[model samples]
Target: MTTTPALETVGITKSYGSHSVLRGVDLAVPAGSVVALLGSNGAGKTTLVRILSTLLRADGGTASVNGHDVATQPGAVRESISLTGQFAAVDEVLTGRENLVLVAQLRHLEDPGGTADGLLARFGLSDAGSRRVATYSGGMRRRLDIAMSLIGDPPVLFLDEPTTGLDPQSRIEVWRTVRELAGRGTTVLLTTQYLDEAEQLADRIAILHEGRILTDGTLAELKQLLPPSRVEYVEKQPTLEDVFLALVGHDTTAT
Candidate 1:
């Protein structure tokens, strides 16, 4: 039998008093696919995530996680999905292993300790398993936080700016992990401000601006929305950076 979409939002709208945050936003994420929500700040990315995860209610329309409605069936939706926000939520007082164990226990796993240890190893935190989260580096804590999110092995994962504060190496590491998760059939809805990140990881992309989706399509399709890729010949070898600067007419290094 065919499975339902891992996530779906139809005509979702949200507002803050007189200020509208989302206006009839619609989205659908197929099972085992990675969908990147691309937007600048105040574009309603976080608000969308919150509503989908059942933390906030939409003013209109509806959303579902694995066929469970976010409004009337929030508990079922919560059981089928996991969310990791921009900031790591690991407890400073708990050890890396302890945090994972806590999550497993909350999920009512039969063997929380074993599951936690396995996750610690998977995220390369085996050596730091016993170390207090307070002493772990930013990357390590973020890894642990993500590990905790996977304790239940939920089918749908929502990652919102997960690499925001990480160093380059750590960001790459997280990217690899995300790719691996999607490869293993986890439906991922990722929100990121980094255009390059979306280009690299998204199977499909949706651009959000001013609380509405400006466009949604594959990377190649989105590229087609812009001008055609131009070819410039030069005697010297021009780097991708140079090409980007020539095409976009802005110094990428300055940002």
Candidate 2:
């Protein structure tokens, strides 16, 4: 039996005047799995995400989330999904716990305080729950933003360049959170420009280029597209990211 996709788009098109952002893009993401929409800047990844999130209308074609048509049933589509954008959306004036409480209350969940506390613990922000968000590190702020988005427990999640501008350790923190979310059966549609990020997180990867999907497949499948390679011995070196992570250590307590 085939499982229905949690998110899908077919012949999806978007344009601004003479400039086209998405040109007949087609893609599908399986339920409870992460699918990375990898692309360079201006590759229409954010446009597709906005359309699916009901934040923007598509010029043509169709898209859906959790089986609800994005065009015809936008309310239902929004109800089933959560969107986290490039920057953290937390209120700097509010404490971490207060931010979570605000979202829970906005979502009209019962026991909003309890919900906030639970989310704080889940996101490993419990120790800093009373601290103002202004004092939090980039990683902490991003984690709090994500925790707020989870208040409604939306089945589908759209993370649009979630780690953009974050430090290496912070990026890794967000990555760990994404992995945990996927483990709990959340369907994630992650848009990213980072090849390593996609390779690390996505169960399947789709490369969007020139407003179209250039390729969509597992990492190994994508590698097979290149010509057969001859073996060559190469010296191993720690990458900048590796050096940074090692020097900074993995402790979040300093934040």
Candidate 3:
């Protein structure tokens, strides 16, 4: 049997007056997989995501999340997905655990406290669960923000440049978290400008340019679009990240 896409959009169009933000965009994401919407700033990545998440209505075209139409069944669409924006949205005044508990309670889930505790441990935030969010590092705050998004266990996740301003180490931390989430079978639609991030996480990468999808394929497939480079051998050198991690005594391979 064929499986329907976990998320999909067809001819999705949006604009601000005459300045179009998205033009006839078509994309599909398979269940329990990660698809990166790769684009630079002003490429309409966020606009597409907002439309998919039902946060903004498209000027034209149809979109769906977990089988629910974004336009006709917006409530169901919203119920089936979670959105994490460019920056952490955690309440600085609340403790990490408190933030999770608040979302669980708002969702009317059973045993909110238990749910909070479980998520804290799941996100590796148990030790800091009692600390106010204001005290957490950028990575920790981002992690907690993501944990809160999981309260309802939405099957489709929309991450809009999740690691935008994070330092290298913190970016790696978020990368590890995304990998873990995908491993647990969540369908993720990640929008990012970082080519390395897409290479590291996406099963398939879709390049959006000038309000349209310019290309879509696996990394290997995309690379084929360019002529092969002449073979050469040189002494291997560590990247700056490698040197920095070494100086800091951090295990580059560690999650």
Question: Which of the numbered candidates is closest to the native, going by highest lDDT?
Answer: 2
* Residue lDDT tens for model 1, 213-249: 8898889998898888789986998877567556755
lDDT of each: 0.87, 0.92, 0.90
TM-score of each: 0.89, 0.97, 0.95
Question: What is the per-residue lDDT of model 2 for residues 18-123, given as tens digits with 9 covering 90 to 100?
Answer: 9999999999999999999999899999999999999999999989899999999999998999999999999999999999898888888889999999998899
Point out where model 3 deviates above 4 Å. Answer: 1-3, 251-255
Q: Write the per-residue lDDT of candidate 3 for residues 120-173, one digit (tens) a residue.
A: 989888888999999888888888888999988999898999999987878888
Deviation from native of the Cα of residue 56 in model 1, angstroms: 0.4
> lDDT order of candidates, best first?
2, 3, 1
CA shift at 56, candidate 2, in angstroms?
A: 0.7
Which pairs, if any, clash in model 1? none
